[model samples]
Target: MLNHEVYHKFAPNQQYSYALSYRRQNVYDEKAPYHNEGVEQEFRLYGRYAYTFKLSERWKWKNTLRQEFRKFLLQTFTRQKRIFSLEPD
Candidate 1:
């Protein structure tokens, strides 16, 4: 699935603001031996932050930071093979 996200700041003097996000499931292959695009899943999230500081009346400095996370769940088609990802990074 795809999602559209937005954020807003209400305070006038709010030089610092932040937002968070979350999601689940990624790349769940549920196809047969014929390789059918029956069902698949994936998830991703990202966050960003910024801070404003004034060095002079006309000059201001802005610093920003960002972070993100991604997850995927790939299920096996056969009963013998186990289902799971090695690292969820």
Candidate 2:
């Protein structure tokens, strides 16, 4: 899995410019076809800010804030075990 996004503005401050995001996930085996082998490599970074105060430009109301964090897949998947045992001899 791979995703990338980019947005930049700093010459005139287009609503307080700032945007950059990236994603990556890798795992080997299991038929191996979804970008196999890297054993999960995730790196997330996000920072966004927007402000608009016009109240008369055709109805204005804009406010945005974002913050993200994640450094490589740490693995988290647990909840599947419904009893399966029968051996008494």
Candidate 3:
């Protein structure tokens, strides 16, 4: 598996931030019981936004929202549509 992310602070006070990320994964198996002949590849793209605020002198509060797009492929690099999905938080 491999992943990469980049983050930026958009607010001057550092209260707001955003990030973009990408991830890749590979699965290997000795038998072909399902799709991809037991070997599969996955890729993910993510976008995130965050806001931070002070709740007290010694404590801080933060909220984050993330969105993800996922893609799956067979060993032959053929795209798989049955497992496609989106996630939001």
Candidate 4:
């Protein structure tokens, strides 16, 4: 597997980041016993954005958003995967 990441700070307490990664699976002769099907590669990309604010002397608010994209094998073919999430405090 290989990964690459980048991060940027928008403020002292806020930042955004993303990552790219790739993974591979190997099938040996004992596993698949096929000459043409021996390896498979999968790739994924995702990012996150976060911000924090002071709400009170003893309290604070934080929010985050995340998104991801990927491809995976299904029954007989590959399919795209997309995900998104948001968190607040």
In model 2, which residue pairs have backbone atoms overlapping below 3 Å?
Answer: none
- Reference-based TM-score, model 3: 0.63
lDDT of 3: 0.65
Query: Which order, best to worst by lDDT?
Result: 4, 3, 2, 1
Candidate 1 structure quality by residue, lDDT tens digits, 33-73: 54443333434465556666778899988777655554444
List where candidate 4 sits over 4 angstroms from the true fold.
Answer: 26-38, 52-63, 73-89
Candidate with more favorable, higher TM-score: 2 or 3? 3
For candidate 4, lDDT tens digit of each residue in 1-89?
89898999988889999998776776456455555444555567889899989889899898989787765543334543432223221
Give residue 43's lDDT in candidate 2 (0 to 100): 49
TM-score of 4: 0.51
* C-alpha positional error of residue 58 in candidate 3 after TM-score superposition, expressed in Å: 3.4
Highest-TM-score candidate: 3
Clashes in model 3: which pairs?
none
Sorted by TM-score, highest first, which candidate order results?
3, 4, 1, 2
Residue-by-residue lDDT tens digits, candidate 3, 30-88: 57763343456767777777777878889988787777877777767788765766955
User: Higher TM-score: candidate 1 or 2?
Assistant: 1
Of 2 and 4, the candidate ranking higher by lDDT:
4
Residues forming the 10-long window of minimal summed lDDT in candidate 3: 13-22
How many clashes (backbone N, Cα, C below 3 Å) per candidate? 3, 0, 0, 0
